[model samples]
Target: MSILFQAYPLARAALFSMDAETAHEVTLSTLQRAYDCGVTRKLMHEQPETPTTLMGLTLRNPVGLAAGLDKNGAHIDALGNLGFGFVEVGTVTPRAQPGNPKPRIFRLPRAQALINRLGFNNLGLETFIANVQRSQWRQQGGILGLNIGKNADTPIERAADDYVLGLAGVYPHADYVTVNISSPNTKNLRALQGEDELAALLAQLRDKRAELADQHQRHVPLLVKIAPDLTDAQIDAIADLLPRHGIDGVIATNTTLSRDAVTGLPHAEEAGGLSGPPVHELSLGVIAKLRQRMGTDYPIIGVGGIVSGKQAREKIAAGANAVQVYTGLIYRGPALVSECVQAIRGM
Candidate 1:
């Protein structure tokens, strides 16, 4: 393990002492500087290369950095160096907006979890694309997935317009685009996962992708990110929509509103989505059901509550084509990336 990865406990202690969002900003800024100075290269050991293919895109490995960690795509190259097969950035929207009120993120250390209602706070689509253009992650041969969502001020009825604008703006730069409809932070965003809303959204996206494909002369895959707080019927409903709408893949789970697993833990009652070990089974259940419903060939990227390599393998065992990490990264540090890659490759 690299010295930096090994020192994560101490780093986590320091970061944990600050407010969650502040610590997040500090980490990203420090990482960007570290990468610029070539420090990350020295601190990160060579990760195992286990080439895998998903949704027609080649991944160096099956482990990915889930969206929300680097909301603006600003740290793609830096974060990618920590040994992810891919780094997905953003929940960016059509217009810039400050997210929910302060204290939006809470740490629940005893349960090894976090609850956040960040509400897609980001630098907006144009600035996000500019950051993507400035990054070397794409040229470095790492798969880059851009995740898009609707702006908060946009009414739920007109949500499609924001998504349409998002799709057109990001289609050219993304290796794949993740349509994030499952973030519990955004008001009524999870409603998009409902059958009627989901069907209409996917239909529009399918047509838009067709038009964008013609204009860009390259077909970028579209994947939908769903929530763990879904019923068996809802899971089946989503599975039925993907292929029908020409959706390329599904990211099984964003975060969960259910606190069943951490009922009395600190921050457990917080309003946002709960992530970490708490959501593991919920995510696996969704992945398993999606695989059963979509059959063997449909692409499913599993994410939610993976704090260990064993859990990473569990995602695959439950039928994930690939896996992603966000809360796991926060608690376990960079070493979790290599650990997951090795575990999944070994599988």
Candidate 2:
């Protein structure tokens, strides 16, 4: 086995032993330190290959660090040099708030999955935008996408205001912006997925996009991130609504609240969304549904349960223009990035 693969179990064990949130902070800090000391520069230079483009943005490769990993835009530069094609930061809300009490994040090592009810805990939109503005990676031409959301206390009816505010705040600095409407932790948030609500949200965002384009003299793509638990009817509604509202793309899934695959695991009953192997089929199904509804030409970014090159290929075949990895990155390490990129190249 490669050194990376060998080290993964040890690293995972160490991280898993700590409180999940604390371990996440420690990992981010370590990455930031490595980035500051130029360790990431050497790693990137010595790694497999150079850059590529996706969604009209220049990416160093196709392997992107998904949102929820760096909720507040911390570690963008650090993560960028770790060889991700792009980095998505935040499910940043309009206001900062402590998420659900302790034990919000759970791990099912046997299934290589994570369940997090992080409740959109973030540094808030202002801090998030400032961090992105100050990012060395953004200044250095790295592709960064901002994932935006409403404050936890914000009622579902007025969620569009939060999205619009976030979009406006991040527009000047982001390569593209993602509207995250799928997180299960937020009460009634997924209701936005309904045909009428989703149509209204997209229409509002499209109007904002036009205004931003005119104001900034550039067009920024707006991608909608959905939940894997949606029914065919809901997915069909989304597919039908997307083009009508000029939505740029679709992120096939967020995490799932179902525990279908890890039913007996110790933490399987946790009240957050589950991601990893258990989410594979559902996420793929969502991707396939979106692909069929939107057609091959529409861009679809598949995410969830992608632990290996083969899985990534399956997502591509299922019809993802690009794929994002989170839990898989936790289980597989940086090596999985190159592995999946190579796999996509072969395809």
lDDT of candidate 1 over 141-166, digit per residue (tens): 88999999999989998999999999
Residue 312, candidate 1: alpha-carbon lDDT: 99
lDDT of 2 by residue, 1-347 (tens): 25534676788789888988899898889778867986567555544554655668777667788999999897788888777777899999989989888879888889989899989998898898888877878666678899999988888899999999989989988899999999999999999999999989998999999999999999998899999999889989999998889888899889998887898998999999999878989999999988888877888888999999999899989999888999998888878887898898788
**Candidate 1, residue 45: lDDT:** 39
Measured against the true structure, the TM-scores of the candidates, in listed sequence, are 0.98, 0.96
Worst 10 residues of 2 by lDDT: 42-51
RMSD of every prediction: 1.1, 1.7
CA error at residue 256 for candidate 2, angstroms: 0.5
Location of the lowest summed lDDT over 10 successive residues in candidate 1: 40-49
Misplaced by over 4 Å in model 2 are 1-6, 47-52
Q: For model 2, which pairs clash?
A: none
